[model samples]
Target: MSSASAQPANEPDNVFRDPAFRHFWFARLCTTIGYQILTVAVGWQMYALTNDAFMLGMVGLVQFLPSIVLLLMSGHVADRFDRRIIVRTCQMVEALIAVAMAVASFSGWITSEYIFLFVALLGGTRAFETPTLQALLPSVVTPRQLPRAVALASSATQAAIIIGPALGGFAYVAGPGVVYTISAVLFSIAALMVFTLKLRQAPQRLTAPVSVKTLFAGFAYIRSNPVLLGAISLDLFAVLLGGATALLPIYAKDILHTGPWGLGLLRSSPAIGALVTALWLARNPLNRRVGRVMFGAVAIFGVATMVFGISTWLPLSMAALVVLGASDMISVVVRSTLVQLDTPDDMRGRVGAVNSVFIGASNQLGEFESGVTAALLGPVGAVLLGGFGTLCVVAAWMKLFPMLTNRDQLHDHSAHGSGKAATAR
Candidate 1:
């Protein structure tokens, strides 16, 4: 068995016992909630200033573009630097950006253009921050603890999705400036918490040479590993095809005959389901038959999406969404644990960057895809097709990546190489 399969030895079972992991978790929580709040505040402010629906779309585009444009560089930087410091530095930068936004907003000098520029900067910092933070996790807790750690960490994000926007909405009553101020304070706390962390890392990772080969090394390494490629791409395609979230506003309004309050429940349902499921997994993990479970979970996700699509009743729609979210959480935990434990620590950053790209692309593109499809096919038709398409993706993945389909345990197959050896290929 590989070290990834290493059961708890002397280390405690509760991940929070390790003060390092505890700090890491809190930092994750703070940043996730802070970012969520900031996102709501910024979008609201931009719309308030311009009163243009088109500008709202640009806000997302400006934020998302940086992650794609800087993917290769960000990955390499994560592998070459002190990841803890990288994470802390990025958070601090975000805090300053938030503060600047608050000042500009309160001063009544902020423009939609300025807001776009600020978010673009925020996106760039996050491009560095996300992958470095992912790579930093295994160092925070022992290998045996990583599965639980990922689950717990996921729970934090889900909880934040529920908490942040609602809090931001309430704060927006005071004005977007108040929301920005709150986010800045949260980002500062996250940075300080990250600063307090002490990682038990492997040997110092050497800086890879800055060449075309090194720049694309993460992409190359993932391609060479079929299991890794399968897991990551499965997530990409599943979310791409099946995400009905973009059509939720339509579903709430046109199909369900509901208003803003109904839309809120529809949106909250998935996050609530995901949070509960993540907490459950944190307490009781699924180590055995991981690949099969992942496939089943995704299949459930597809089914739930279809159920949500066809349902006319509000309660049924929300229930399907809850199932959709819980199932996706299971797949995410499995995929995240597999990706982290299977990759070499030296290459984790670069690989994580690629993973982030896929994730970001899936989300942004998924919403776009849903919109295009909805326009062509009615919203119900669009969602149903997405659900069915997700199922097709699952079937295709199982056939194309039998190694992934046949995987027995989450932690059993890892035998990673050094960065030098990995890059040499």
Candidate 2:
């Protein structure tokens, strides 16, 4: 029998069988859960305390500033240092921040300013951790297994995102302190799992001394690669304009007339759709029409966002969010796979840093934008405008980056040659 035929239908391939990757997957699940819980808890508490739309947006800004400020240093650190250690150290810092949040909430000292301060610290931890974690993935799995690995990893995270928010919302009924304490415990568990992993990494060989030029190598590399730039930029601008998550708390309370549990359900709805799609992708990975699929998925995301923006009923809003999450997952997997496949191993760390920065801008800066827009236009108007803006971005990107739109098949590196070649010119 052929090797493919010999593999049992019920069993996962060797990628799932790998012990190290399994542990890493579990660690990611735990970490995602912790972070999601923290997000729900903080967002709810911040809105409750200040009742100001802009202040809620400032919450995102505070978390975002640290990552951008340390972007270069973060990439360099991941490249030069032991990545496992870097990830673990960052997790420890996050755990401490969670602890501080718990104490603050319990004492009734958790003002918006204090929440912003703690979240800022958590963002600093994320700045160092994200690139290292991204770079570390290749060490755990073989190149051939990477697509499945990415899918499984994404599924794990989506599962956590689905569960964490609902649990946090219920815990919020008891108090923010309870939700924070759970986050602290989960963070510590994730750290311990990372510590236990025996990663297969090549010895670090720094060929060049650290300098201004060396630090900015990621930017230069990305600039020279139009495919990479186009892919990242598409996601950055589309989501930046389309995101309505920061205003969710307001929607749940004022627009939808839902309580804390309803808020949790709202948060989890997207992840539920994402998790379902992720699991299916893990079993049957995408190989053909990769670029077209990404573009189509993003367009769906924009349409769904508009639907959710206008929705007054809970079920309609939740359904829209579900579609929104499902569409975004396709873009996430494609962009991540492309970035990982194209970059040289030595430069992956720095490239991962650049990727993280783009993500932060889309998510964090996007939240700030939502807040400002909500203040000016009201929540419904802000989200509607964002969704329309996202569609325009997609059209513009299609015209500007024809390479991305015309591209076929994701697994083939040769298809990306035009983008890379365009960069060198």
lDDT by residue (tens digit), candidate 2, 176-246? 99999999999899899899987655634335788887788889878777667889999999889998877
Report the number of the highest-TM-score candidate.
Answer: 1
lDDT of each: 0.90, 0.84
> lDDT tens string, model 1, 1-425?
57534655545366878888889999999999999999999888888889999899989999999999999999889888888899999999999999999999999999988999999999999999999999899988877788999999999889999999999999999998899999999999999999999986652474657899888888998898878899999999999999799899999899999999999999999999999999999988896788889999999999999999999999999999999999999999999988888887778888999999999999999999999999999998999999999999999999998988988876663434443366556
Candidate 2 displacement at residue 64 in angstroms: 1.8
**Model 1: residues with Cα > 4 Å off, grouped in runs:** 1-12, 417-425
Candidate 1 clashing pairs?
none
Worst 10 residues of 1 by lDDT: 412-421
User: What lDDT score is found at residue 302 in candidate 1?
Assistant: 96
- Candidate 1: Cα lDDT at 344: 78
Measured on C-alpha atoms, candidate 2 has an lDDT of 0.84
Candidate 2 collision pairs: none
